[model samples]
Target: MIQNIINQNAYTALDQEEYQRRYDSLVERFDTTKADLELTTEQIKDKITRHRNLEIFLGELKNQGNLITKFDPLLWNSLVDYATVFEKQKVEINFNSGITIAVK
Candidate 1:
């Protein structure tokens, strides 16, 4: 029964290897997703700060009675376009196992 025992041990070792591989892959994916989320959060915070600064500028211009003239419509339109693009952006990752994950 030593041969049978050897075969069983080999099977167990292969199974353990497979499990480790899957676990490692999952950990890698989790780390990547976490990093992506952190980057996204930073981007959002930056956008908020930019919007706040814009508001402050507008308020100052209003105090000077130059709100309309000092604000270039073209520039404002471009900023709006950029914000729209950012808001509409979607990040999708597809795995070999036919699994798809999206972050927006």
Candidate 2:
């Protein structure tokens, strides 16, 4: 889209200033739109990586049998990433599967 706008053929116009104004406006739009596209593409790629990590983690968990009755340090290490504690007893626990839980 940006390239097509930039490479478009131009014909003689009665108003040269008007043509320049429109062309400059298109150039500005092209820059901003290209930046936005790049940002969104990176976000999508990150989400895809996060999702695959979650799928693999869950599959391993599913094969580990029934509920656990004892404290398992290895399991805990595999599941939790880090935790954030805020004021007033508010805490956020981040998991290995890109999920977070807030406790208040």
Candidate 3:
């Protein structure tokens, strides 16, 4: 939509009202697209940050020991800051380093 506007040659105004109407419509479309792009960019950045944090958390967990073993309080303390046990036997663990993992 905005591409078609860009392709058009500079406006030579035959009537003042018509020229103003076209110019305003173009500006409105550009503003809407710009706002949408900003929002999408922010969402992408948030996902990238979460992914990086998850990678770091996994690295720390791997360095600790085998995950399948019996629960070790010391290892849990080293990695997790705190945890919340919710209804339905769900648990949300907040790691001291950076990420949160929910389990059931």
Candidate 4:
């Protein structure tokens, strides 16, 4: 009876240790994942800001009539290239207020 009690206690202790180890590992992974998510969020925000600035620059260039007939083709090509690259790496942000912004 005492031996049975000893065996049960040992088994319980081993099980508890294993559970603690697994729990610790899970918590560490969660922390790492949270950090990665935060970094990604910041990067997306930066991309949106860059896109907004580019739009403003494009508008200014247009207003200044920098795209004459001779320069139109080159300007169009450059715009197309920019659009393609932006589309390829586009980020979509959906806010809690049900607003969606596409940054490309």
Q: What are the lDDT figures for the candidates, one per model?
A: 0.60, 0.77, 0.74, 0.61
lDDT: the better of candidates 2 and 4: 2
Poorest lDDT segment (10 consecutive residues) of candidate 2: 5-14
Candidates' TM-scores?
Answer: 0.50, 0.61, 0.56, 0.50
Candidate 1 regions exceeding 4 Å error are: 1-14, 66-104
> For residues 12-100, what per-residue lDDT tens digits would candidate 2 score against the true structure?
43365765677788889989999999999999998897787777667767877888777867667667889999999999999877789
Which of candidates 2 and 3 is the stronger one according to TM-score? 2
Cα lDDT of model 4 by residue, 30-67, tens digit = 78999999999999998886676567657756776644
Candidate 4 worst ten-residue window by lDDT: 77-86
lDDT of 4 at 3: 46
Expressed as tens digits, the lDDT of each residue in 57-89 for candidate 1 is 556556665436566654444234222123477
RMSD to native, candidate 3: 6.2
Which is better, 1 or 2, measured by lDDT? 2
Candidate 1: which pairs clash?
none
Instruction: State candidate 4's TM-score.
Output: 0.50
Candidate 3 clash total?
0
Candidate 3 matches the true fold with a TM-score of 0.56
RMSD of each: 14.8, 3.9, 6.2, 12.4
lDDT of 3 at 32: 92
TM-score of 1: 0.50
Point out where model 3 deviates above 4 Å.
1-11, 67-104
